[model samples]
Target: MKKILILANNDVGLYKFRKELIRELVKDYKVYISLPNGNLIPELEKLGCEFIETPINRRGTNPITDVKLLWRYKKIIKSTNPDVVLTYTIKPNVYGGIVSRISKVPYISNITGLGSAVENGGILQKVTLTLYKLSLKKAHCVFFQNKENEEFLSSNISIGNKRLIPGSGVNLEQYSLLDYPKSKEIHFLFIARVMKEKGINQYLEAAEYIKKKHPNTVFNILGSCEEEYEEKLKEMNNKGIIRYHGMQKDVQKYFRTAHCTIHPTYYPEGMSNVLLESAASGRPVITTNRSGCREIVDDQENGFIVMQQDSKDLIQKIEKFISLSYESQKGMGIYGRKKVEKEFDRNIVVEAYINEIEKINKSIS
Candidate 1:
């Protein structure tokens, strides 16, 4: 049997995003997974796959610790001797690819997004981009979740093989729409990690402005607050402008009951799973015109796309939705459901991965 090894920074990255792909691959290959320990190990084991406990720091950089991680992964690769490797996230794609190259194991990488390093341009961005260009040059195949990212790689890096897949595909059947709930109040939901880059503060400010005119309108935020922005977010939550539900495991439940999903991210994203899931659940989206977020939303059709970081533009869009008739709102949501069915279905994406893997195997063989 062909041997496959998967690498990720955290267990959630393996569990939430790549679970479907893993399940499919395990049928024919001896699959091994490497990630930080988390709640997913038992479930992954249940799927008849082997797991290796690899300590990977999911957050900020430490040169000393990163070197240790590189050595550890190098050891793992040398021992496992897998025929093929798949890696995702910035650290894994760059560092893992380098290790795989040294081991002479064929590998594929998925660049989900350009995170802080590239988004917050500086020395780190320059260094990370250089590393990416180097690591990605000879990759068997490099997949991007958005065209903007693909374009960046084509223009800036010397990547030879590339593919573009939608954001970790949404299960259209699972996220089936419910009837638009009739309520005295209209609720807007924002689901994302509570980071400045996610436009959390912008959402709060827009909520405050909207509430002043339409006091009954509700603004709800469902996401985990990180240490960097916790204090400020808590203060905002204390005010009646936004209702905080922390991180939610089942966001589809919330999406079903809400009128619209707001994702005003200024930071570049790979196609956002939140936006796709929300649209799949039949909720219209209000997000930025930026690359990853914009792909899922068609302005004035299924949802609206406002300019990034423009609180005034966000507030205007909110008001526009608020003023729409009940039938018009429902129509927007119906359009979204249709969009999801036609475009972001999970099966389509899984098959795409399978095809890519097969192509890689043929080429290398």
Candidate 2:
């Protein structure tokens, strides 16, 4: 049996997004995963795969610790001597790719998103891009979640084999649509981490504007709050502009009941799981005119796509949805569900990974 090593920064990357792939790989190979410890350790262990703990900071910039992490990962690669190394996220893809190259191990990487590095465009962006170009030079294949990222790499980086997959696919069966509830009021939902980059403040501003005219409409937000924005969001919640449901485990419950999901993110995203999940749950989406977010929504079809960071445009779109008849909104939701079935099903994504792994395996053999 072959040995495969998976590296990621977060538990979701190891446990949720790659669960089916890991299970399938373990059937024919010795599959080992390395990630920072999180809530999913028990679940991952239950799947009969080996887990290794590693220190990975998903945020912040520290030169000394980062150098130490790179060396530690290289040592692990030398010890594991796996047939292939699969990695995701920025730090893992860059550092892990370098380690795999040095160990003469075939490897693949997924560029989940450009992240704040490229979005902010400072010293970090330059440093990360340089690292990516160097590390990915010898990769077996590089997968991107959106066209923008793919185009950026092909044009800038020297990577040869490249592919695109939909953002980590949503489980369609689990996100099935419920019957549209009859209510005299309309509910708008914003589901994401409480970050300024995610357009949380823009959503709040739009909600405030809309509520003054459409007093009966309900605006709700569901996600964890970062310390920077918690106070501001809480103040808006107190004023009844938006109801904050912080860090929910079961967002599907809210999706089943909400009229539409609003994601006016200014940040670069891979493919937004929230938008895909919302659409799968039979709800329309209103997102920004950006790469990953725009792919899931068709303007004026299933949902609307407003200019990024434009609170006024967001408010207008909200009013447009509110003005529509209940039946029309339901129709939009139905269309969104159909879109998910056709394009963003979890099984489709899993199959893509299977195919990629098999292709790489054959080449190496």
Candidate 3:
């Protein structure tokens, strides 16, 4: 059987977002995954992936640590001797791509998102773009989740054999459509890390302002607090400004009661999985007018697109949603569901990977 080695920064994201592709690959290939050890290892093992516990400082810029990671990828690639290497996230994509090229192995890379370092621009963006250009020069194929990311990278680097895919498309079956709620109290959900770039402060501010005027409205926050916002979240949760459900494994239950999903993120994203999942669960979304977000929303049709980091615009959009007639609100959700079903189905991503890997395998054979 052919061997496939996958490298990523974290296990939870790999399992949560790309499990469909991994599951399909394991059936026909000997699949190995290298990522930082996390709670989801047992779950991935159940899906027939051999997990290689790799220590990765996902956001750090230490040269020694990065060199160590490169050495580790070299070791893993040499030992595994896989037919094709697959890499995701920043560190793995760069370090792993470099090692794969040196070892004369065909590899595919997924530009999931440009991290804050690159998106913010400055010396860091130049450094990162230089690294990307160096590592991705010899890649067998490059998969970009959003056109903006693709265009940015292409303009900066000489790339080959690139393909665009929906950001790790949502599973239609797992997030099946729920019945639109009939409650008079509007429920809005924010599902993402409680970080500054994710527009948490904006969400909180909007919640505070809207909750005061529409006292019956409910604001819900889900996902882990990766930064220093835990105390703030707790304080707001206690005050009834928002209900914080920290890091949920099953989000569909929350979607059941949510009238709409609000993801006011300004972070550079390849695609916003939260928006796709929310749309798949038959809920309308209100998100920023950025690349990852704007594509998921049809302006006034399926959902509203707020200006990035503009609390006033986010607040205005939230109020507009509040003012929507019940029928119109539900219709927006219906439209979102149809849109995801047509465009963001997980099967599309799975098939893309299969075809790409097949092409690589046949060419090498």
Winning candidate number (TM-score): 3
For each candidate in turn, give its C-alpha RMSD to the true structure in angstroms. Answer: 1.6, 1.3, 1.0
Better of 1 and 3 by lDDT: 3
Residues forming the 10-long window of minimal summed lDDT in candidate 3:
226-235
* Over 4 Å off, model 3: none
Clashing pairs in 3: none
**lDDT for model 3:** 0.93
What is candidate 2's lDDT per residue for 139-232, written digit by digit as tens? Answer: 9888889999999877778988888888888877777886775787788999888888999878988888888999988899998888998888
The local distance difference test score of each candidate is: 0.85, 0.86, 0.93
Lowest lDDT 10-mer window, candidate 1?
Answer: 228-237
TM-score of each: 0.95, 0.97, 0.98
Ranking by lDDT: 3, 2, 1
The count of backbone overlaps in candidate 1 is 0
Give the best candidate by lDDT: 3
For candidate 3, the TM-score is: 0.98
Backbone clashes in candidate 3 total 0
Candidate 2 — which residues are off by over 4 angstroms?
none
